[model samples]
Each structure stands twice: as structure tokens, then as C-alpha cells.
Target chain A: MRVALHLAYNGTHFFGSQTQKETSKTVLGELENVLKKLGIEQKVVASGRTDKGVHATMQVCHIDLPPYWDDMEKLKKVLNKMLCDALHVKKIIHVKDDFHARYSAKKRSYRYIITTKQKNPFESDFVTFLEDVNLQQIQQNIGLFVGEHDFRQFMKTGSDVKSTTRIIYRAFAYQHKDYIVLYFEANGFLRSQIRLMVGALLTLTKDAIQAQLNGTKKYKIKPAPPNGLYLSKIKY
Target chain B: MRVALHLAYNGTHFFGSQTQKETSKTVLGELENVLKKLGIEQKVVASGRTDKGVHATMQVCHIDLPPYWDDMEKLKKVLNKMLCDALHVKKIIHVKDDFHARYSAKKRSYRYIITTKQKNPFESDFVTFLEDVNLQQIQQNIGLFVGEHDFRQFMKTGSDVKSTTRIIYRAFAYQHKDYIVLYFEANGFLRSQIRLMVGALLTLTKDAIQAQLNGTKKYKIKPAPPNGLYLSKIKY
Candidate 1:
């Protein structure tokens, strides 16, 4: 039986979402290890692979459990106890065998947070503090990223994907207390895409406002720092 | 002339509050290096030392600047730009030669935050998340920590403090959103004192009715996990 698990994890301790030979500290590897210990086969697939130090609020994954274990209630309890504090299973539901974690997903949502205040000792890990950001210009420039566009200029140069075109269903920036949150939703994301986009937005807000205002093709944009980006939700 | 500079630092990247022989990553060492580069000969003095993985909201420090650099406004700007991102100068005031950051401070306050919900990826570094806790019980038990008490039982085993009797002006636990913030104020604190108190409170709250009914003798407690505790505010 295939079980879909909605989960969340603190990516600070993990070496990204995918498993690596040198460092098996990824979230997927840890979940697989726990499943194996429970006498389940190591057949787990995730909705997406987040970069190192990136966090997710609702990441979906599917794992095959033995047919004999019928009680999902008991299984969830066992898995919760076995997993480390950094990883948590929010919900588990038995799904059809045809259910796929990655390919079946329709949309993904991400939120990137940046702070303008001095370093908050309390929220240091989750937010990127950019003291010199120009809030008005950044808010104005974020509208440029709302529609579908060839995002080759906003993605990492070495991304293996064949297509640079992506449909950005939504893109907006807002303030939440001491932090500014940039929301983006799309069918899929390129490697280092969100970070690069956030960086570019921040650069536009900070340095290249005049060029962006003039709609000039010749301009340079820097990506925002990585610590603030988060995978907030995934829809299937 | 010696001037006391009150500062705050996010200690996640720091080795500790004190300077070490091998690694100059301590808060004191960083400040001293910046002072040296700015041609300041004054030695920096801190109120107390904070452990690795700990943080400070308002830690007090004293440093002497050259006579030529007597302008406080310019000094603040220069120091602010010189310090690393993790370290910040909250305030820089010129004090009398006899004033000391350590000895002149009248009271110190520390706050430890623990969350009852699942771990927040955004708050991984700042707050500690415990699975389930009885807040009402913890609030009631905190009353026992107020006033002067020989906190030998709450002190860490190897703490090298000469006096265990300290006046706790405030000790209370309150809830904000999904988090419980425990605030403690005292003339001084022993090593790992706040963590130990929080640990004891957690144990007490786990069995609320019993703890509330029991007297002071039952207050012997464990140290709360270190990461959640912060040197929140220092009142001098």
C-alpha cells in the first residue's frame, strides 16, 4: 500500500532534500532509514528537492508500506517517535498505488522572508536581514514577475533543465510585522530558481531601480540571500 | 578615557562569549579585532560569558576609544559598520572611568522560549519546541522561583559559582501564540541557571496538580535544553 505523508522539517541540519553519498543527512534519507527499521521497504518519493538550509511547511512524500500493516494510526505514532526532532510527520493518508508524489503535484508555493530591522536574536535562523533595502521600489518591481516569462535570467546558470520558461501564477511582496514576505506560486521551479528570483528582486529594490523603471534590457541584478527562502505549501 | 559600550550579538556563529586561545570567534575577540583595526587601545569588558549556541538581546560591554575619537555619533557609525552582521552595537555611551559593564549593572534578565506545537522551520534557531506541555501548571510553579532562594539544586553540577543565594525579582511563564516564554530576572545567575530552572519547570508542569500542591522542596529541577534559552535583556 502506498501512503502519502504530509510533512515539515527544519532544513538547518539536513544536507538538502535529496540524498548524497558523502552526506546521508537529507530529509528523504532519514525518512527512508526510519521506514526500513520498521520492516518497510525503502520506497519513498518526495514532491520536490529543496536546497540545503531551505525549509518546507507542507512537503508531500509517498512511501510503500507492507500490506500486512493495516493500521495507519499506529504507524503514524511509531514513525513520529522514531524520527528526529527536526523532522515531523504532519499527516498520513493511504493513497492509491497510482498516486505519485512528484509528477502528480499541480502547484508549489514558496515564501521568502527578509527583515529590515537589526538582527533579531529570536528570529535569526528563519529570516534574512537586509537593512538597506528600498521597500517602495522593491514593491513596485515585484509586479514584473507576476506573469509567465523566460526566467533564464533569474535562474542559476548551470541548471540542468532544458526549459527556462516558467508560468508564475502569482508573485507579490508584503510585510508581516518585522519581516517582508515574498510569495511565489508556480507549477514547478528550476534549480536555485526561487533564491535567484528573490535575489534579483532585492537587487532591483536596492541598486537597479532606475534601470528597471526605464525598462532597459541592459542591467545587472543580484539574487537575494538564501537563508530567507522557504517552501510554504505544495498542492496536488 | 574608558567608555562602556552596550551591545547585542546573535551567538549562533560565535564560539562563545569569552575569547579562546585557538579560535578567535568569540564575541569579545570579534569586538577587540574591530577595535584594533579602528586604532582603539581600550580593552573590552563584558558583564558575563554566554555559552556556545546561546544568544544575547542586550549584553553590556565596555571599551576605550582614542582621545581623538571623542565624538560619540561618529564613533557609533564607525563601530556599527565595522562589526560583523551577527554582532551589533545597540548603544554606545561614554561612562565615567570608574563605571564597569560587569560591576555597575544592577540586574540581569533572561528569557527562555519553548513551543508546544510541532517545530517551526522558521524558528529552528530561536525557540525550542517540546511536544506537549501544561502551561497552566508551569505558570503556577514559576511562582516558587521568585524572591531569594538558595538555588543550588537548580544550578548545574559543575558550576563554579561562589554564591547560590540570589534574588529572583521576576519569574513567570506566559503564552504568546504557540510558544511559552519564561522570563527570569535576578541580580546574577549561576552557569546554566536559567536552563536548569526551565527544566525543573517542565518537569513540574508535566504533572501540574502534584507540582502546585507540593512545596519548595519539590522544586529541584532539570536544566531546560540550552538552545531555547537566551540572555534576553539586561537591566543595569
Candidate 2:
């Protein structure tokens, strides 16, 4: 039987979402460990990888389970008990055998939050605080990210990817209390593109760039720090 | 000039609220270091000490500065920027020489929170999650805490305070979403008294103890773990 799990985690302690040798603290690794405790192994796959210190509000993953374990309510309880803290299993549902968490994803949305208020120790692990940023400028710069563009310049240099062009469905920036939240949705993204765009936007807002510099001209955008970015949702 | 600063900190990273020779990574120590950078040294004092892993929503402290440095707004910004991310200065105000951070307090309030749902990493530093708590039973037991009471049995063994009796102006437990928030206001508290009360209440709610096991009787009550308690508010 095929199963889909909607989940979220605070990524501060993980290496990243993808599994790596020796350092098996990734979200997938933890999920797999819990699955192993339930007598299942080698049956899980995630929607995508999130960089270290990145957070997620909703991420989808698919797993293959035995036919006898069909009661999702009981499974959720068991999983919740086993997973305990740090990770949460929001929902569980049976999916078509051929459904893929990565391929079936219609759009991915991300948010980057920056704060100017004095440090909030309670939220330090989840948000990035910037001492300087002009609100009006950041709101203005987000408009440039709404359309499709050749985002090779936004991609990290060492990222292994063939294409750099992607369609951005929506992009905007707004203030939520003390935080400046940058919201972006796209059919897909090049590696580190969101972070890069955020970094560039912050730079633009700070007036770090000269007036003659064109931020959207493909060669000038820099990736934002990883801590501020969160994979907020994935639509299937 | 004398200034009293209202502050808050996540005590998980600090040893506690007070600075000691062996445990110098304390909230007061960090603030003192920042003060030294501004040419003020050894002139800091806090209202009281909060134990390790005990958070504060509002902790008060006072420091003496040069008479010429009378700009409260500038001092606030300077200290907030200089302090580490784990400590924050919420508000600063110039006060008369007679004002003492510790002695000027009229009352102190604390809130202990416990969640019946799965652990939330976002709130890990702020709240405690108890797996099996009957909210209805806990709610019913809350009325037992109101008014003044001799709380000797509810306090820790080595507490050498002058009095065990305290005036509780408010005491109640309420459910908010997945969490149960327990609030208490008192002239003062004996060490570990709130934690002990909470632990006993949880046990009673779970049927681990008979309903007759109130602290009013001569009985020993175990203190809940330190992570569940917070020095939520200190009034001056």
C-alpha cells in the first residue's frame, strides 16, 4: 500500500532534509528510524531537500506500507507517540501506487522572515533578525520576482542542475508584526534560488546597491542566509 | 543616572539569571558584559534569580550609569544591539535613586504551560508538553489554589525562606488550543512550589493519586521537571 504523509520539522539541528553518511540526523533519517521501529524500512521518500537550518510548515512524503496496516487513525497516534517532539506528522492518507511526492507536486511555496526588533530568544532558532532593512524598498523589489526568468544567476554555483529557468506563480513581501515575510510560489525552483533572491532583496532594501544597479538583471542577486527560509507548503 | 530595564530571556542557554564564578554564562553576566562595553562596570543587579531552563517574559534589572548619559532611547538601542541574541532588553526607563529592582516589586506572577498534543519544536524553549493529561480534571482542580495558603508541603525540602505561606491573588488553569496554561500570582513563592503543585495536580488528574491528595493535607508532592516552569512576569 502507498501512503502519503504531511509533515513539518524545525531544521536547526538537522544537517539538511536529505540523508548523508555518518551524520544521520536529517528529517528523512529520523522519519526512517521511526518507521524502522514500526518494523518497516527502505519504504520512504520525501518531496524535496531543504538546506540546514531551514524550516517547513508543510512538506509531503510517500511511503510504502504493508496491506495489513490500514487504520490511519491508529497509525497517526502510533507515529505521533513515537516521533514525540521536534517532528510532527500532520496527516496521513492512502495514495495511488504511482504517485510520487516529488513529481506530483504542483507548486512549492516558501517564506523568508526577517526581523528588526530586538532579539527574541524564544524565536531565535526559527527567525533571522536583520538590524537594517527599509520596508518600502523590500515591498517594491518583490514585484520583480513575479514572472518567469532565467534564474541561473540565482542558483548556487556548485548546485548540480541542468536548467535555470522556472515559472514563478506569485511573489510578494509584507510585514507580519515584527517580521518581514517574503512569500514566493513557483512550479519549481533552481537550487538555493529563494535564499539568493532574499539576500538580493535585503541588499536592495538596505540601499547597499547603487541606484544604477539593476537587481533583476540576472547577474547581481545573492542568496539570503539559510536560517530565514522555510518551505511553507507543497500543493499536490 | 539610574535606569531600570525590563528584560526577557530564554534561559535554556544560560546557567540561570544570576552570575556566579563557576556559572558565568548567566543572563546577568551577559548583560554586564554588554554594559562594560558601554563603559559601565559591575553596576548591574536583577530582581531575583531564575533557575536553569526557566524562561522569563518580563524580568526587571537596574544599572547605574554616568549622569551625562541620560538619553533612555539611545541607551536602549545600544544595549539591545550589544546584548547576545539569548537576552533582550524589552524596555528601559530612568528611575530615582531610591528605586531598587529587587525590593521595589509589589508582586510577581508565573505561568506554567503544558500541552497534551505532540511536542512542538517551535515552542520547545517556551513550553512543556505532557503526554497524558485530562484537561477537565485539571481544570476542576484549579480552584484549590486561589487565596492565601500555607504551602510548606508543596515546596522543595531545602528551601530556607522565612515563610511558606503566600497570598495567591490569582490561580487558574485554562485550555488554549492544544495547551493548558496555568497562571499564578503571589506576593512571593517558595522554591519549586509551583512545579510541585503542577506535578501533583497532573498526577491527580491522571488518577495516579486519589482525589483526596490535595497539598492542604500533610503530604509530600513531587516537583515537576524544571523545563515546564517559567518565571513569566515580575511586577514592580
Candidate 3:
């Protein structure tokens, strides 16, 4: 039986969503371990990778499990019992064998949360803090990257990607009390694309710096910390 | 120079507000170390004590410093610089030598956060999760705690205190989406009094349990986790 599971996790402690040979704290590693504990020898596939310290509220994944796992209710209860405090299995739905987690039909959305001026001890792990920002200016110009554009300058270093052009269906930044949330949705994202873009946006909010991308060179403003980024939703 | 400092801290990592001979991680231990580094060797005092795993948004304390430490602005910066992420010094105000953090205090306020059904990864460290709850009933009966009452029935074990009668100014619980916040204000609190009261309130909301009292005997409903409680304010 093929099952799709909607999951959420706090990425601060995990290396990332992908499995690594050296650590079992990654999202996939935890999930796979729970699967093994349940007496099921199946491989789990995630929709995409979330960088270390990046949270996820609605990430989707698929797995081929034993026929006994067909009972969605029982499986969720078992998984939740084992994974409650960290990773969560939000929902489970049956899917055709051909449905792929990464390639399956649609868009992905992400959010980056930023708090300004002072650090909140309670929110330190989940929000990035920046000072002296002109949030109004950033919000006004945030739509510049809404359509198709070459995001080569925004991609992180070390990944030799063949293509740099990607279409951003929607993008915006808004304020919620002291926290500013930036939202972006696209067919897919290049590694570290949103963080770099958010970093640039943050820089744009200050008078001291400007975003420089004349042709196709690397942009200033290092990618925002992964702690503030969240893979919020994946739509089919 | 007698100076009072308003402070806040994510107490998850601290032993408590007061220092202990064994652990150096108590809130006062950290504050005292920083004071020592600054060359102010006077004794430090706090408004009250908060247990391990508890948080404080507005804790108060007083320290008799050298006359040179009268520059309130500079002292706050120094203290905050030294105490960065775990603890924060919000404000520093000079006070008379007779003022005391514990005795001269007028009232203290606390907040208890409860997250129902699902465990939110971001708030796991700060909130307690309850499965079945009647928030309405909890709120309706919350006022039962207001005014003066003998909280001896709700006090924790092993604290040989003389008085059990305390005046509560306010007490209530309200829902905010999936989260419920319980508030309490009083002249002062007995060790774990608020938590035991909250625990009894939670049980009272349910159909099966009752808060029993038989002429100064122990009551039911285990104290709620310290993680969910926050010392929000203090009045001088």
C-alpha cells in the first residue's frame, strides 16, 4: 500500500530533512526509525529538503508500506505515540503507487519569520532578529520577484544546478506585531533561494546597503538563518 | 547604591531564580557572576523564586552597588551584554535602601499556557498539552480563586511555611484558538501553589474528578508542568 503522510517538525535540532549516515536526528532518519520499530521495512520519501534549523508545518511525503498499514487511523496513532514531541504525522491518505513526493503535480510554499530590535528569549530558536529596518519599503518592493526571473544570484553556493530560471507564483511580506513574515510560493525552489531573497529584502530595508545583481553574479547579504525559515505548505 | 533591575528569562535551562551551592545555572547565580565581573560585589536579591523549567517576563531584583553604578542606562547595557540569550535585564531603577524585592513587593502575576490535543513543535518547550478540556467551565469557575482564601489544600509538599491564607486579586483562563492561557495575581504565591491550583482547575473541568479537602489534608490533581507557567509581572 502506498501512503502519503502530512508532517510537521521543529528543525532546530535536526540536521535537515534528509537522512545522513552519521546522524539519526534528521527528519527522514527519525521517520524511518519509527517505521522500522513498527516492523515495517519501507523507504520514506519527502517532497523536498528542508535545511538544518528550518521548520516545516505541512510537508508531504510518501511511502510504500505493508498491507496492514492500510488502516490510516491506527497508523497515525502509532506514529504519533512514537513521534509526538518532535516530528508529527498530521494526516495520512492513500495514494496510487505512481504518485511521487517530489514530482507529484504542484506548488510549494514557504515562510520566513523575522523579529526586529531585540531578541526574545522564548522565540530565539524560531525567529531571526534584525535591527534598524525600514519594513515599509521592503513590503512595497517585494513584488519585483513575483514573476519568472533568473534567481541564480539568490541560490546558495556549492550546488551546481543546470537551470537558474524559476517562476514565482506569489510573494509578499507582512507584519504581525513585532514579527515580520515573508511568504513565497512557486513550482519549486532552488536550494537556499528563499533565504537569500529574504536576506536581500532585509538588506533593502536598511539605508546602509543595497541589493546588487547586474548580470548573474552572487548577491550580498548571506542567506538568512535557517532557524527563521519554514516549509509551511505543499499543495497538490 | 541600591538599584532594582527588572528582568526576564527563558528558565528552561536554569535551576531556578535563586542560586544553589550545587548548580551554577540558577538565574541568580548567573546574575551574580556578571555583577562580580563588573566589580560590584554587593549582595543581590530577587522578588521571588521560580522553579526549574519555568519562565519569567517581568521578574524584579535589587542589588546594592557602588555609587559609580548609578548610571542606570550603562548598567543595563552591561548586564544585558553579559547575560545575552538565556536571561535578560529589562530595566534598572534606583531605589531606597529599605526597599526589598520580596517583602516590599505589592503583588505578582503569573500566566499558564496550555496547548490542547496537538503538540506544537515550536511551543513544545513552553506549553503543556491537554487532551479533553472544558475551557468554558474552567473560565466560569476561575473566579472561585479570587479574594482571600486558605490555599493550604493546594500547596505542595515539604515546604514548612507558617501561613496559608493569601489574597488573590485575579484568576481566569481563556482560549486563544488552540491555546488556553490562565492568569493569576496575588500578594505572593506559595511554592507551586499556582500550578497545583491550575491542576485542580483542569481536573474540575472534567467529569470524573473532584477537588477533595479534609481539614488540612493533601488534595488531588498533580501540579501542572513548570514549563507551561510564566511569571509575567511584579508590582512594587
Candidate 4:
């Protein structure tokens, strides 16, 4: 039986979303370990791969399991209990054998959180901190990323993708709680795409503030830390 | 000179709030060690002690330091940078020679968080989880500890408190996001008092539900996990 699951993880401890070497701790590695412990042998197929230390509120994945393991709610609880902390399979639902986790997904959304307000010790692992943030200017320039464009400038170098062009369904920066969150929904994101875009937006915001401070303006874009990036949603 | 500080700690890694054995990781031990490295020698006195795995958002303490340490903000930044994480001195303020953290004459407040909703991996260490939660019944019984009461039953056994009678200034349970929080303001609480009270309240809530369901009432009281308890505020 093929099963699709919605996963949520802190990602602070895991190496990344994809399964790499045996010694490395990855999300898929943990999943397979837990499944083996439960007497099920399977390989998991995920909708996308997130970089190291990146979190997910909603990541989709598929796995093949024994047909006898049909109680999804109970299975979810058992998996969460066995996995204990860090990585979790939040929901378990049966899927068609032909349905794939990656190819069947239509859109994905990622949110990047930056806070000028004080972040507590428990939350320090999840938010990016900055001294100055110009919200109004970020609001004005955020739409520049809404249409389809070559995001090669916003991608981490050494990543090979067939196309540098990707459609941006939505891109906006807004205040959430004490943090500024930039939400990006697109058909797909390149390697470290959302983080690089957030970095660029933060630079632009800083540049706007610098332009106000002095006559000259500057732009420097580097990817924000993976801690603040969340794979929030996937629209299939 | 005596210096008072506003302290915050995640407490997940520390053994406890007190400095015990020479090699233990504790809040005071960490503070004194950092101070020693910075060329200041002082024994700290805290307003109260927290048990293992407990957290504090606003703990008060006093310590004697080299009289030259007058710059509060810089000292605070250095301490935070040096301490790195887990435990921190949030604010550093000078106090009179006679001021003491423990002997200060005022109220203290603690909050216990209970969740029927899902707690994330990052937050699972800070909240108590239960299956069945009846909010209205718990709300109705929350004022049981509002006034002075003999809380001997609530205290963990073998604790050597001088008095079991303490004034409870306020006690109530309120909804915060997806969790129910029981807040207690008091002159002082016996060891494990707040956690035990929450446990009793939860049992009572379960009994009330059972009474409604099967027409049988029951009561069970046990100390809740230390993770869910937070020493939120101290007043002087």
C-alpha cells in the first residue's frame, strides 16, 4: 500500500530534508529508521528537498507500507511516540500507488521570518535577527518578485537546474507577531531560493534605510540562515 | 556592591536553578563561572530556586561584583554574549548594599501550561500534554487557591519548607492560543506546589467529565512535569 504523509519538523538537528549518507542525520533517514523499528521496510519519496536547518510546517511525502497497517490515527501516534522529538509524520493517509509525492504537487509556499524584536532562547533557533528593518520599503518592492522572472540571481551558486525561470504566484512581506515574515508561493523554488530572496529583500530594506541615512545606497544579498525558513504549505 | 539582575533561562539543559555539586551545570554555577572568567568573583543569591527542567521568564537575583562594573547595558551584553544560550542575565541593575534576592518582601507568579492541542518538537519540552481537557470545569474550579490556603497536600513530599500556609494573591486558568494556562500569584509557593496544583486540577477536570459521562466521580493528584512550569514573574 502506498501512503502519503504530512510532515513537520524543527530541522535544527537534522542535516537536511533529503536522505544522504548513512552517517548523516537527514529527515528521510530518521523516517526510514522509525519505519524499520515499526517492522515496515520502505523508502520515502518527498515533495521537495529543504536545506540544512530549514523547518517545515507542511512537507508532503509518500511511502509504501504493509497493508495490515491501516489504522492511520494510531499509526501516526505510534510514529510520533517512537520518533519522540524533532521529526514527525503528522498525518497518514492512503494514496493511489501511481500518485507520486513530487510530480503530483502543483505549488509550494515558504515563509522566512526575521525579527527586530527580542527573540527568546527557545525561539532563537527558529528566527533570524536583525537590528534595523524598513517595513514600508519592503512592502513597496516585494511585488517586484510576484511575476515570473529569472531567479538565477536569487539562487545559490553551483546549483544546476534546467531552468532559472520559475513562476512566482505570490510574494509579500508583512508583520506577523513581533517578526517580519516574507511569504513566497511558487511552482518551485531553486536551491536555497526562498532564503536568497529573503536575503535580497532584507538588503533592499537596508539599502532603503541607508539611502535615507546617507546620500549613497548599497545592495548586498546573502542567504539568510536556514533556521528561519519554513516550508509552510503545498498545494496539490 | 550588590547587583540585582532580571534573569531568563530555558532550563532545558541545566540540572536545576541552584548550584549543587562542584561539577554540575546549574544557573548559579554558570553565572559565577562566567563572572570568574571575566575577573569578577562573586557568590550569587537568587529570589528562589527552580527544579530540574523548569524555566524562568523573569527570575530575580543579586550578586556582589567588582564595584567598577557600573555600566549595566554593556555588562548585560557581555554576559549574554558570554553565556551564549540556555541561561542569561536579561538586565543588570545596581542595588543597595543590603538588598537580597531571597529576602526581598513581595509576591511571585508562576504559570503552568496544559495542551490538548499538538505541541511542536521545539515546544514539547515546555508544555504538559493531556488527552481529554474540559476547559469550562477547570475554569470554574480555578479560584480554589486564590486566598490563603494550607497547601501541604500540594507540596512534594520530603521538601523542608518552614510553613505550608501561604497567601495566594490570585489563581486562574486562561486560554492562550491552543493551550490552557494556570496562573498563580502568591507570597510564596511550597516545593512543587504549582505543578501539583495543575495536576490536581487536571484530574478534577477529568473526574468532572467522567461524572458527566458515567455518573461516577473520581480524583487523582500527582505532580505535573517540570517542563510545563514557568516562574514568570517576581515582585519586590
- Cα lDDT of model 2 by residue, B1-236, tens digit: 77899998887768888887886689998888888888888657887778888888888989888887888888888888888777888889988898888888778888888876666666666677776887778777766767788777777788788878888888888888877888888887777778877887876543333333344345456667676677777777
lDDT per residue as tens, model 1, A134-193:
667678877777666767666666777778777888888888887788899998888887
lDDT winner between candidates 2 and 3 = 3
lDDT of 4 by residue, B84-112 (tens): 46777778888888888988849999998
Worst 10 residues of 1 chain A by lDDT: A206-215
Q: Which candidate number would show the highest TM-score if scored against the true structure?
A: 1
Q: Rank the candidates by TM-score, best first.
A: 1, 3, 2, 4
lDDT of all predictions, in order shown?
A: 0.78, 0.79, 0.83, 0.82
Global Cα lDDT for candidate 4: 0.82
Q: Candidate 4: misplaced stretches above 4 Å?
A: A12-30, A77-90, A103-106, A139-170, A176-178, A204-222, B12-38, B41-43, B77-90, B103-106, B118-126, B135-179, B186-191, B204-222
Please tell me which predicted candidate would have the highest lDDT against the true structure.
3
| Tens digits of lDDT, candidate 2, A130-220 | 7788878878777777777777667778988777778899998888888889999998888888887787777754343322133334345
Off by over 4 Å in 1: A33-44, A68-70, A82-84, A117-119, A131-143, A146-148, A175-179, A204-219, B11-15, B22-25, B33-43, B73-75, B78-85, B131-143, B174-179, B204-221
Quote each prediction's TM-score.
Answer: 0.82, 0.77, 0.78, 0.76
Mark the regions of model 3 whose C-alpha exceeds 4 Å error after superposition: A12-15, A19-26, A33-37, A41-43, A103-106, A115-126, A136-170, A174-179, A204-220, B12-44, B77-87, B115-119, B122-126, B135-181, B204-220
lDDT of 2 at A144: 77
Question: Which window of 10 residues has the lowest lDDT sum in candidate 2 chain B?
Answer: B207-216
* lDDT of model 2, residue A6: 90
- Highest-scoring model, DockQ: 2
Q: How good is the docking of model 3, by CAPRI class?
A: acceptable
List pairs with backbone clashes in candidate 1.
A199-A223, A199-A224, B195-B224, B196-B223
- Assess each model's interface with DockQ, reporting 2 decimals per model: 0.26, 0.47, 0.41, 0.35
